[model samples]
Target: MKAGTPDLATLGHRIRHFRGERGLTLDQLGELVGLAGSQLSLIENGKREPKLSTLDALAAALDVQLADLLAREAPSPRAALELELGRAQASPLYQSLGLPPVRPGRGITDETLAAIVGLHRELQRRASEAIATPEEARRANTDLRERMRARDNHLPDIEELAEEQVRASGHRSGALTHREVSVMAERLGFKLIYVDDLPDSTRSITDLANGRIYLPPASIPGGHGLRSMALQAMGHRLLGHQPPASYDEFLWQRLQINYFAAACLMPQEASVAFLSQAKKEKRLAIEDFRDAFGVTHEAAALRFTNLATVHLDMTLHFLRVNGDGALLKGYENDGLPLPTDVTGSIEGQWVCKRWRARRAFEETNRTTENYQYTDTPAGTFWCATQTGRTDATEFSITVGVPFNQAKWFRGRETTVRAESRCPDESCCRRAPDPLAERWAGQAWPSARLHAHVLSPLPSGTFPGVDDAEVYAFLEAHAGK
Candidate 1:
């Protein structure tokens, strides 16, 4: 309800919990508080701000102290203050108002702090903007990662649905053929359309009301990406998930659909059997998985994270990075140390040049997967990376496991090794002292921000556009 206020979402949940505990309905609570049922419902849903008097009345009606509704057990006072400070720093409205960004560990009076937060709320109201920032994105990633870790990053529900989909389509595993995928889409009631000149921002658009899926020839022509996109579109339709209301929810929903798509492309039972056999023979390779499952290396790498972590009892991490070394996507359940500032941002941080993922960019041999063992503060991790070029950028997809688990991978015999102290100074990122001494004043590399690093957060609707615009465009292009 208010910017930088103690989590109102949590407070609202507590309010609902207390109301249910006391066996009170919204109408009953509203009556007791001399408020309307609609107002109470809005307050409970966190859609409306309640006056202090109203909160007091609701507290009285619920027989709980207001503090009980707002208290959070974790996050030390310093940490909580830092989180609030981050929200303020990332606030565009705060920036527009010419207010100084709040820095953690900076002492401020309660009066100053309240004023800053008040201005933040006022700015939000004036701008009518969604507060999606790097800080919020990191928080979202952390929340989703926690949920995935709780379930070992495996979705049994989606897996079951995928298996059922396979059986219904008369395809019992391995790889779903294009004809089978077409039949599956038809059965799901979506007519597929491929347009050679679809917008770059849109990969595939689902006009659910008309039951059509418009795909771009460039983004997904034919192969793993195409099938994955088709199944992903169908996934959104069949899984019954509403469009996301927040950036974090959008990311979570995307992953859910992608998991479903992967499940359909490579059924869990069959994939596991192949992976198990590969492991038994000590011949696990991304290429082998990709060929066997008829998916891209990226898909294979991600699916391996899903299954290997849960089924094979292997701790793993996956990363997709661009040529500029910015992490586009990453996930780890194995406590891998990734680059992050104190604010916990991850996606745009520069991957250490010495890491296998970064080395993939310089790789001339496109067919061979780059492998390396890198020692970190945590320990040595063996990673394999494959490079590929998209129309927009050249990128690499990498998967890594702890050194002990390297024996289970095909590239275990690689002699490449490097020491890394990422997110730390004095690592290989620093130019060698000898070179620096020789050319201290003669040479320098220009520092330029990678465009991806500066790219704005994807809209809550489709990947890069709002839902209304997408719908309107679809309406205009409906018949043509």
Candidate 2:
């Protein structure tokens, strides 16, 4: 009997799709097979058949069973996903690669859930080994820099960079309004859900060892900016990184990227300058800036928060836009501890003054009256103060910037006073509730952007805020 006359060429075609779905371009797979891409294409399309040794080599390169490589055709979505993910895992792009796959049954597990946490920890033994060190990162950075140069050479326009940034941040264009963040999540298939919907002290956001992703909602009273932020953050974690085993680290990363995203969207000198002109003339109120600069109020306020830079003295400089809820962005310090009550809504006041007042009082300015915050319906904040007994009483210059960079944080967060602190004790309160004051509105973080949505983990879930347990788990996975 003749050895099965397998359509050896068709078998090669099957392998090609597997590699493609795994996100390997033809060149990459062909290199593995010791042939140029054109040669592989000829084989895959059935013009020729690879030798038995060649086929085996291809299977080894792809990490697939040779028979399966020969047999698979039009693989399932999950299979295709595995290929795409495998590519990401093995790609030289990520600084640190292969975050522990999310476990099944994931929605942020509690630390004390009485667990396989020990096993989970042991699993991390190999994970740290995979951490992308600075040395490994150098190559990726070089590659990125080369790509960036190529981008500049090809496009060379600021707007083009904006579009590219939007794409990489995992969002689409044509709907980049104040609400586009939610739209992006919707596109990704996530839903806007309430924190109450999740168990208390849940992982909140994470990746499971089994490969699912979960994130909190994007809507909250006045949380539009945060919603925008969470859209990218959840999208990113949903993409390359995993939730940090540590909350401080996790939140810090979130804060860093959120700031970076803002910088990307409304990029430097230009972005802040537009904000400055708007604030100086009071033309960019939350509703107003949307139409003017075509950005969200949260973004405007974020610019305002940068005003609290240590570079400036008690002379407070803030770029107050607006936002609300539990996003944890409004507080000048990411290190500030959060309250358990989870106060979810602050009215539409700017976020810079609360911290400015803290700095002002720390700078020897007398705390004044308890004022009902005009920005919100919540408690009072340090609104303003007299520079001296003789300074103009009505206006403490409404917190103006220096004529040049003298008062700016690298020339950012251009802000002006909406109002000075009222001397009436009833109008201004010296003590500001960091959490309550940080809040600017009550909108829920938007539901997950469908485009940003992801499947839940059914395998191992994230450990709760327990440090040691999570550390051990991370250590175990790191070792793995």
Candidate 3:
């Protein structure tokens, strides 16, 4: 075969393995299938395509169904689409659909071809529109992230609105008080209700008809947490977003609200000023930023990425990972390499344990920020990580800068160094020979596989929103 050409290397290996498992030589298999040894070998080695009759004969010889011979890793989407289109043109269904027959090496009229393609496109569109999965959600999220990157992750309109709200409330210089946030919601025609038990799947829910925003108690205590939730809920009303039609719209809407909330909590002028001073003094610490603004570490890290990348001429990577090491969220305006699967999602991939983000989970003191120096294929980076635990899981909030840009951060002084060769087995999955000889299987902690990797994403608007509950609530308040 020509180099770099498509071939059935995996199928050839499977055929050889199955043949060996059956304790039969190629000649014996050829004899059973009534084919010469050379022809059978060519088929086994993917040098030639087999006819359906030959495949059926081979299946019978192997005591398996015809479908079993063809089932394996699926082809790419474009390849699969082409294959389906080719099959459809020759199918009886095409004739039933009143479409003209398509013959190989023959040209059809342009109008007829257009009609067939239009019909196929409509069917594929309808199929995609019906159900939503986690994969779909991730794809949607990735798409939105790319859009944001194109704009450098800055939204001037939303930021201006948030800053105006902050300045009007007279809290631009300090943390927005709970009373101030409640009053702001009241002014925006929203009533806030705090509950002790909220569904694990949701942090807050908005009753649009009743103008009531419900929040869980866990989200109520923090100076920033409750306020952020309230602002996000109010933001939807102020921003005039309609009900989302797809998972992509749902994520984009949620992201818009989150950005509005962050901007409200950390106003533009004051935040940029504070960050600028910190950079000049070489005192840019995430915890200090959190304490100064009375926000969570995650919130501070997010705001840092927003402002630093735009105004301060700094590039950074922000990451959030669970204790089990699955990346919950990540972004890099810098050119640092982030691991992504073939579909370009980083959410459920495991982070290298040697990296500060994953290693923070092992610390005895989660409050103390962990710092480390790391070398990656991209370059050397200095990272700062802080851990936060909730009722559900422990998460590490991490911020990292390239080695050249690390001097402005306090964590740059760390002497610790580790190397990461991730997105590969040698990094975390397999052990080095020296460690394998010592304590590889004996004392190493087994990483927990996150279910998000396997869990199907929700179909439709909001994963678990109940239309029936909404109707019931509306009816209950009808007479009130």
| Candidate 1 lDDT trough over 10 residues, lowest sum | 73-82
Residue 66's C-alpha lDDT in candidate 2? Answer: 75
| lDDT of model 2 at position 140 | 36
The reply for model 1, stretches above 4 Å from the true place, is 1-131, 197-200, 217-221, 432-446, 450-463, 466-469
Task: Please give the RMSD of candidate 1 to the true structure.
Answer: 14.8
- In candidate 1, what are the lDDT values of residues 1-480, reduced to their tens digit? 455355554455567778888999989989999988898888765567788888888888889887775555312443344445556666665665576666433477655666666666665643332336556677788678678877878999999999888788889656798778878888988887877645556678888788888776635445677888888989987888886656766778888999999999889999999999999898888889989878888888988888997788899899999898988788887767887657665777788878989877776798879899999888999989999988898999998999999999998999999988876767856678888799888977899865645565664344466666566678777878
Evaluation by TM-score, superior candidate among 2 and 3: 3
Q: Which pairs in model 1 have colliding backbones? A: none
What stretches of model 2 exceed 4 Å from their correct place?
Answer: 1-175, 186-196, 202-226, 243-251, 260-273, 276-299, 304-480
User: What overall lDDT, based on C-alpha atoms, would model 3 receive against the true structure?
Assistant: 0.76
Candidate 3 per-residue lDDT over residues 1-480, each given as its tens digit: 334322453344445555666888989999998988888788765567777687788778877665656655323333333334565665554554686744322265545555666677675564355356667777887888788877677888999989877766656467878877887787777878886544555667787777778786744456577889889988888789887766677778888999999998888888899889989988789998888778988998998888887898888899999888888899887766776777798887788888999888888987768999899877888889999989998899999988988888887788889998776678877978898899855886778775765777543345556545545654664455
Compared to the true structure, candidate 2 yields what TM-score?
0.30
lDDT of 2 by residue, 1-480 (tens): 115434544455477667876788879988877989998888765578778788798889888887776663434433333333333334343324455543323243433222334444444533432343333333333343234323321222333443445555454332244445544444455533333233334444332342322334545444444545545544454335565543333433454455544544454445445556654554433233333444554454444444323212212222222122112222323212112122222112223343332233234434331111222222222232222222322112112222232222221332422333333222344445675577646446866443312422111223223444444543443333
